[model samples]
Target: MVIYIILFGYLGLSLLLSRLNIRSKIEDSAQYYLTNRSLKGITLFFTLVATNFSAFFFIGFAGESYRVGYIYYTMMAFGTSFAAISFYLIGSPAWRLSKDKGYITPAEMLGDQMNSTALTRLTALLMIIFMVPFVAIQIIGAGLIVSGLTQGAIPYIWGSALLMVFILVYIWRSGMYSVARLDVTNGILLMTLIILAFVFVSRSLGGISEINEQLMEQSAALFSPQGSNSTYSPSLWLSYMVLWLTCLPMFPQIFLRFLMAKKESNFRYTSFLYTIVPPLLFIFPVALGVMGHLSFPDLQGKAADQIIPRLLTMHLPGGFGAVILTGALAAFVSTTDSTLLALSSLIARDLYKPIFKPQLDEKGTLTVGRISILILCLISLVIAFFQPASIFQIAAMTFSGLSIFFPVFLAVLRFNYRKPISAILAMILGEVVLILFATIFSGACDTLNILPVVPGVLATILILWLGHFFEKNKD
Candidate 1:
């Protein structure tokens, strides 16, 4: 009941803000989608952090840490560093191009820059395809948290639906501007929750020093990979790093953030902040996992994702528990809104506007974007109803699947790999190879720590090179 109250309180606040901030019907359509391009440095910074962190960071990251050990931190390091690199390399250029061309979506930027209608359509199609899985993962996370706290009374579908309703109400009102402001508030709540959880939980477990001692005593591998209890081998480490380095940055939500900035300088400053903040955020979850090991080592399966919730419910006092749980719910809600908005924009601007109706005005685009948001949210709610796998597992699978496209996009921007044929070949070869390798030698390869996409990446490269060579010769 306390948890429910805390969550709805936040939802109520978000809805209220959305109602106040929404673009008036009399206002132009540009004000609705882009929030009049008036985001300042701080709001942009929080939006960047909130979107990038997501429910994946809270639930998925902690879950991964529990199952995989400290090697998960390496994944965070790879993602943050490489994403920053991509931001600087790809983001700066995309910002400049979008501003100059008045492009709103990534598909528009790619389509206009390359002058290929087919390429634009393909990018939008691929984005929609990938975004379903991505949005589904977040819905699963939100559902898991709500269902776990409510103890099976709330059903996953209802859990997802409730959150989505609030999200829809808020987004329908204010669009991106309302989402950004709420995210800033969510960020503050997240930090407060983390600091409090760490301090209180560590005290309960006997102090930081004692907790460290307990972890080492329980699983020396948690401290040192060279130790006998360590699960990660060299092969697994390499695969993990490669998968994250090549793949993590291309998240469409992250790319949409590059579009949200009021100025190019915001992108540059935010990238620098990313490198610093992600590592600090990793500390809270890493510490929680270590303590969880010492306290509840035998918990397994889906129980892993529930460790923190179980900890709070079983141990903490009333009001404090509600506050911290509210923070967790906030994390989930903020990430979901950002993702829904991104997916909606892709469908609205890219899929609907230029291809289907060349004459889509601002009002038409806004209607289409809102409608897209509703359709996508419904799809995710349906997927969340099944609730087969852990949210983290689904997220990891989706991340690997999307890894196929990062190289192609990076090549197009940084290198001269602009041939549409090369781009298509890379995506196809990479996906096929990934599917084949994961299928045939599935258990052995997975045990050996080989990423599903490694084999496909090699094929993608070869095909891309051959296509580029042929195109150059034809010229």
Candidate 2:
């Protein structure tokens, strides 16, 4: 426990370095939210990747890999690489637009483009509603990490509460500047430790042949695509690819990242890296989870979610799990900070000022944004504490819900694609379809092991296409 505390304290100190002598002017929203758009090169690269990834990258991936098999790798890699391509396709153009129009938030850009305050508020509300679960997943990972590190001396709720408070204070200190700086360090730390954890565990298992021999003897189901429990159906695999390609780019944290590029080349350089790097990093956790079955094959229920941590602590030397978990803690904190910051910006700029408090000045808006951070932290923590779902389940639901906004972004970037009403109808019907499939007719939704996002994304595009066609007919 002391070792875990010391390593985590070191991680905390590294994050604290972001606040050292970093003086940010919070009197203006753009300056606070975007770091004055000065991000580029390594800073931009780390910031975007770290902000885009969360505990979901490690905790969720490993857990799913443990549940299914390495086939989990295919969906995330292909899907996310396509999602990365959007950095050039959707992001570069949007960056230029934001630069020209002085737009800061996604809803602000969409609302102004379509001339609809209602759409602005609706988009903002939905993003927040869907994103909170994603945020809760971070807290859940942190809570699990903390409990594991302390050997259950600290309960999950208290662990989650600690992470929430830290994120709030960190954001209040210097906004995006601190968050970006923390991400630079955390990003490197997480990448290194994940790879290290993989090496250490694999070595302990006596390399590939032994692992394969053990797997074939004890858990042959791992080599199959249907997974140990037989959940990874073909439709579900394709659904994951589509979901990441469409949904990841629309995440408020990721969308906001588009507006922060210091140069056009930032998109080019980062796009290539984004396509390749995330997928490579994903392989380790998934492999670790698969290998984990060799040690603990009978992990029933949610115990599988703890596969990576259990593997690290039980297999490796003392204090090693502490170090790796510190990386885990950093991954969670890095994600929650960016997520909370982006959501606060959306609520403050898009909803609060325009809808309720039109007279708010820049400073007042900043204050509102900070306060919203606190409220959102509380809300996310509450959800984290009571969450009955696994990280993958929560992630799947949130990703699908947020993906409904893709058509709106599609119409926004392709000027010829917008008939404002068409975009609005597309977004609304997309969400409605998503809810129906996920709930009302869920049995029907699951018949072929299909996911709601598949239909949701298709329905969204179908509406947009129909709107475009009718407009041409009327013309």
The CA lDDT of each predicted structure is 0.72, 0.80
Provide TM-scores for the models. 0.91, 0.93
Worst 10 residues of 1 by lDDT: 21-30
Q: Cα lDDT for residue 160, model 2? A: 90
- Which ranges in model 2 have alpha carbons more than 4 Å from their true place? 225-230, 386-396, 469-475
Question: Over the stretch 1-475, how does candidate 1's per-residue lDDT look in tens digits?
Answer: 7767766777787677556655556243345555655665778888778776777666656666777677677667555655677787777777776667676677767766666777677877877776786788777778777777677788877888898888898777567778888878888777678677777877887898988887777777767752234556677667766676566556677776776678888778878887787777777876776677867887777677766666666568865766787777778878888778877877888878877898988777888889989998988887777655654354556666667766766676677566776666677678777777777767767776677767666677777778866765212
Clash count, candidate 1 = 0
lDDT winner: 2
Q: What lDDT does model 1 reach?
A: 0.72
Displacement of residue 48 (Cα, Å) in model 2 is 1.6
Specify the poorest-scoring 10-residue window by lDDT in model 2: 466-475
Q: Model 2 — TM-score against the truth?
A: 0.93
TM-score of 1: 0.91
Give residue 255's error in model 2 in angstroms.
Answer: 0.8
User: In model 2, which residue pairs have backbone atoms overlapping below 3 Å?
Assistant: none
